[model samples]
Target chain A: TQLLEQSPQFLSIQEGENLTVYCNSSSVFSSLQWYRQEPGEGPVLLVTVVTGGEVKKLKRLTFQFGDARKDSSLHITAAQTGDTGLYLCAGALLENAGNMLTFGGGTRLMVKP
Target chain B: DVKVTQSSRYLVKRTGEKVFLECVQDMDHENMFWYRQDPGLGLRLIYFSYDVKMKEKGDIPEGYSVSREKKERFSLILESASTNQTSMYLCASSFGGLHSPLHFGNGTRLTVT
Candidate 1:
């Protein structure tokens, strides 16, 4: 089975602090996606990285897909309280697998003002 | 903007009861998915449909079944509700392809007593 393992299951930091969360797996994927979920809501897609070694930025958030397509990372620069949420990484398998996704255990981030 | 709407925000049911959770998407996407979220496990896919009347088992489909009789609607069914099945159920939709991002609904929190 394809599995994505996320690090630092919980994080609490003051506003303006920086943090990085990682998603790793032994199996290679065709693409990687990051999502953020708030309390009482389903996850919303934040970014998707399709090419190996690709990096995508959305305001203060930076997402990176590893060269081998087996890992990914999300980094926040100067995190604000608004950035607090559960961050999830999902790996999408090849087309033959119907492009199905395998999600990692989430990283819950709390940014205090 | 894509909107995925779930029928219920919260539900309470007794053990051994049959339950149905409904979801609809306004984007007319060709793919829909059902997932369950727990405290530690981020999100586990239960079922998915790529077309009307077509269903596929996902990673954790043991306690659940799904129906997709219409293009814009997907339903998740619990034949026999159990305490272990209590979770936050999420509904998502996406255009059929390799790189499409999923649009999600506000989840339904189901409690089995």
Candidate 2:
């Protein structure tokens, strides 16, 4: 079974602070994805990084896939209350997992103003 | 806009009761998934379907089962609801194959009392 380990299960920071959440694994993946979920809602996809060392940015969030495809990071700049949510990382592997996503434990962020 | 709708936003069931959660996607997606979200456990996949009546077990499928009688709809059934089974249920749909991001429903919060 593929396991994606995410660090800092919980985080609390003031608005405007910058933070990074990480997803690491011993196995390489074909692609890695990041999602943010708010209360009472399912997760919304933020970014999909397929290539190693690739970086994608959305206004205040920057996502980077490690050079080895075994890790990823999400950096939030000038975070706001709207950025507070549960962030999850998933991986698509080559082991014929049928494109099923293996999810991480997730990092729950609380941005207080 | 791709919209996935779950039948109920919140539900309460008694232990040992048969529970069903429904999800429908307006888009003609080929892949559908069911996941459970807890406070610290994050999201755990329960089942997925690539086509009608073709269901695959996900990471955590022990006490839950799923049915996909149609492409647009997927249903999750709790044969015998347990207290520990109380959690937020999420449903998601993806138009394309692997590497494509998923569009998720609002989610169903099931509390078994």
lDDT for model 2, please. Answer: 0.91
Tens digit per residue, CA lDDT, model 1, B1-113: 99999999999999999999999999889999999998778789999999999999988999899999999999999999999999999999999788778889999999999
Please tell me how candidate 2 rates in CAPRI terms.
medium
Candidate 1: residue A49 Cα off by (Å): 0.4
lDDT of each: 0.92, 0.91
lDDT (C-alpha) at residue B11 in model 2: 98
Q: After the best TM-score superposition of candidate 1, give how far the Cα of residue B98 lies from its true spot, in angstroms.
A: 1.2
Off by over 4 Å in 2: none
Q: Model 1 off-target regions past 4 Å?
A: none
Report the C-alpha displacement of residue B32, candidate 2, in angstroms: 0.9
